[model samples]
Target: MRARTLLTWANGTTLAGLAIARATGATIRPGRDGVLIAEGYTRRIPKNTCFTVGSVIFTRRTAEWLLADERTDLFGHESRHVGQYAALGPLFWPAYYLFCGYSYAMTGSYGCRNALEKHAGLHAGGYDPDHPLRPWAARFRRRRSENG
Candidate 1:
């Protein structure tokens, strides 16, 4: 079910979510299903991720970007979760396992090992990659509080 706010009688929105989308190339499109995943037939990604807004698949460079503490590329971990959610909707959990080596990241007690946490870590690494909070984003990996 789509949220009333997400549907403003239109199918697209443009906000100030620049940093995250700019580096990862993830865009915000309007749809009842929520963030539409392009470039695939399956409704879910093939990994383990922290969030559910964007795709999570990453090459060595992206993986290093997620794991590394550097600030070269943008959208470190949190952005990946965004990709996860954008790519996989209902199947984000099972899809997260496809992250390859992210489980070790979220299994600790100090920092974030969940996909969302990781995404935040990456985006907020040495610098702030994006806004502190994505007001426009849905619950993504989790359901809205009103539903429960």
Candidate 2:
């Protein structure tokens, strides 16, 4: 295991992810780099087609869908989440949820203002990259017009 992967394991996040994968009956397999891919997730609570926890990435579709040329951007997006898990360890969970709530409140979209999602590239994650908080976008437009 890489140092970063070991860090997530030591922190218990990766283990938790693996446990979830097992419970969901997803087919687990090794993926490129240090990430693990868990596909055909049976749960529908998350609603997202893809999500990442620690070094394990869960998807509702086959892993080949993510590996396909057209979806490489999404794969890269989830890989960034693996790095985030390594850095934040178990704290990533709470922090991510908090960001999700905050982002939704601010822009009515969970990924719009989320630090984690922004850092991971919203477009790659199938989010609207240009969607900004309404108030902020309005304020910026007002300021730009005034300066002209």
Name the top TM-score candidate: 2
User: What are the Cα lDDT values of the candidates?
Assistant: 0.35, 0.88
In lDDT terms, how accurate is model 2? Answer: 0.88
Error of 1 at 85 (Å): 1.0
* 10 residues in a row with least lDDT, candidate 2: 129-138
State the lDDT of candidate 1 residue by residue for 60-141, as single tens digits.
2233333344532333444434444444443554544544234443232222343444554643433233423223233432
Predicted structure 1, TM vs. truth: 0.22
Clash number for each model? 31, 0
Backbone clashes in candidate 2 total 0
Error of 1 at 70 (Å): 8.1
Residue 26 of model 1 has an lDDT of 47
Single out the weakest 10-residue window by summed lDDT for candidate 1.
8-17
lDDT of model 1 at residue 93?
A: 45
Residue 46 error, candidate 1, Å:
22
